[model samples]
Target: MARMISYCMRIIEIPMLYLQKRLGISRLAWVFLLPNLLLFGLFAFLPVVLNFVYAMTGSDQILLQDRTFVGMGNYQTLTSCEDFLNPNSCKDDLFWRAVYNTFWFVLLQVGFMVGFALLTALMLNSKIRARGFFRSVFFFPVLLSPVVVALIWKWILQREGLANAALEGMGFDTINWLLDRHWAFFWSVFISVWAHMGFYTLILLAGLQAIPRDVYEAASMDAASPFRTFRRITLPLLMPTMIVVLVLSLIKSVQTFDEVYAFTGGGPGSATTLLIQYVYETGFAGTPRLFGLASAASILLAVVLVILTCLQLWASRRNVNG
Candidate 1:
């Protein structure tokens, strides 16, 4: 089998080697790139094209051939509403609920995550005992599979799980962490922040380390307090990196799906359901899949991400100019 595989690979390489000899390096490069370009076209570009095509149609059917073309019908349906302000009054309440949840999720989660990550990065950057160990310990969770992280947190937050058991042991009433809407939302945000905070912390720590030691020494020579040094020197220098982190975290927070889905399943009456989950459940999870609607939702999500990316670029450019 090994010899046969080697023979097949040699057979495949022979034509390419012949072409490399016959053609120029530039042409040979295309020969090498053909497979990857074909794959990218088939998978990435094809799906995006098909998704847009599907989004323009109205279909209960799975195949594009069976679907009916309904120019902007799906988008119109999504936008149809008496009151956009009140999601419950909208035609598609679930979509609006998801939007609302995602809004709060991004706001709260990104806020807390960035704050905590900055604090953690600051500590990790300081001269401290066992610094390498502490850094590794903080970052270990980021290397865990999202599914595993979710499961671990889910087990800890369950009614009879470690959290409640601890409460009972401490002579406090056990609180339902996963069942109630507020608690479910809280834990969802908290767990997501916990799982990914290390990543942002590391980014910030890199930014922290890149600052010149001479700057700190100069600040110290000027009899500057630690707070003043951080405020004036550290923060001002760190703004560009912080902005990058902020934009990345915002985009990621918006696209949150795996961990929340694995842990909460968007449960407790869809209290923790995000826009991505809404798209998934609509497109594939039900008896009658709303592919067109889901496609529309996906396109909207793409638009949001594009806008965010543009804003990030603009901010970066402004920082450069300033």
Candidate 2:
């Protein structure tokens, strides 16, 4: 009977040891996660919280001073106030114009960028010679810094630059690419599309490559034409990637400041003035900077981006289900 009791005790002790080992493994997994969580909280979450706080108070002008709590006063000022940086002040027409211009810029840029990316991806995915070299050339633009791309295009589009010189050599009249408002906007859009299309192309190419070859072969066996196969199979499978490219391009285009600032400086009567540029000009351009107002505008921009991202996510989910 004592021997039997000893065997039962050993059985119970074995399970306890197994449970302890499992717990130890779980703790080790969590230890690996902790560092990433702490870094994300410190860098991303904390800055967002601070931005929210700064948006509610008048902090731009008095950085060192204690800011007055204004409730939703800053937001209210944004709705009706003309000056983006000053809600207490009257309306400013330039602010609204900048908003309109930014919308146009986003619409044009996203449309062209995504359309061209899809086209290039399709071309690159074909069974053509020199595919590797062509793919590399197409993706080269994305590897360059945005500032560098803008500067290179700036030189190319100048009055007596390569483009105009080529046109003149062809016996065409030299066109003022940057001086005229319409032409300046055109060049900006062109440069943005050229510089960005490569990244999206590479993304779409990856999506294309992931699609199994057997699917296309099966479609062909069923007497499906190339166009029909693409319309029915390729497009549906690519929807997720398309949605990603669209959302990213839209957000970047809407928040466009660096390239525009470096190229146009929001010049020629505010022709290329984007929303972010307006915020910068309002807060930092003049003698007395309006930090509170700038913060409000920044919050508004963030809200817009969040809304668009949510919409894209919903659309992508629907596509996947359908």
Candidate 3:
């Protein structure tokens, strides 16, 4: 064991001597950086480049040699329609429908997520009874797997589940939650907000705690009402964290698939189908799996996310500078 340890030390020391004498770089820097850089290039950068290559091809074949180059044919087909506003007029109507559904999901989910998270954070941050217990209860859902959360809600929304049972006991009809178009969409948004609100609530709570207590004390001494104190001090101070929550919520809402898929399976006539689900079903799930079309859609989604991220950075910079 001592000889083995000495051998390993010699190997490392040789590299150190070579790097220090020949390259003028500390061997330690390469040790820290090379592995991560190689991993990022292989896993992250390579896939993105391959996805773009696939998007330009016009074949269902997974192999690069078998794929026929079609230039912008896949993209053109997606944008080809009598009217771009109406998805039904397009050849790939399901893709357009998924885009519309995703837009609606982001609209409602981000609002409800930020609003509910703010309320919960405020409540938990107060001197209420069992504050720690309540905080734990709220955050527990976040720690659960997304699939688990969706399945739990699916069971609750079933005909014989607790939700329907409560309705039946109240002399109200047991509505089919997952089978309805509007209700399925509503519950998708609701369940997503419920599952993720805890995370954003924790972020806002941290922001709230970072705020100096003296500011609130000053407001109280000035005879400021609770609303006035929040409006004049809390909201202004919390804007940065709120912006982060908003941007993250928008991006996540756009990429929503796993939980909603487990819950609804994009059923009731494509009511809850989002862009990611559309891409999955197109590329791998359905007959005549259109890999090219799916790749185009994936590229579009990536472009949208990139634009959102750029906007976020720009807004953050503007806020800081102003």
Task: Estimate every model's Cα lDDT from 0 to 1.
Answer: 0.93, 0.83, 0.91
- Index of the highest-lDDT prediction: 1
Write the candidate numbers in order of decreasing TM-score.
3, 1, 2
Candidate 3 TM-score over all chains jointly:
0.92
Better of 1 and 2 by TM-score: 1
Error of 1 at 138 (Å): 0.7
lDDT string for model 2 (194-285, tens) is 88899899989998998899999999899999899999999988888888788878877888888888898887888888889878987788
Backbone collision count in every prediction? 0, 3, 0
Tell me the tens digit of each residue's lDDT in model 3 across 183-224. Answer: 999999999999999999999999899889999999999999
Better of 1 and 3 by lDDT: 1
TM-score, candidate number 1? 0.89
Prediction RMSDs, each to the true structure:
3.8, 7.9, 2.4
- Which segments of model 2 are wrong by more than 4 Å? 1-42, 64-71, 81-90, 312-322
TM agreement with the true structure for every prediction:
0.89, 0.80, 0.92
Which of candidates 1 and 3 reaches a greater TM-score?
Answer: 3
Model 1, residue 286: distance off in Å is: 1.3
The most accurate candidate by TM-score is 3
lDDT, candidate 3, equals 0.91
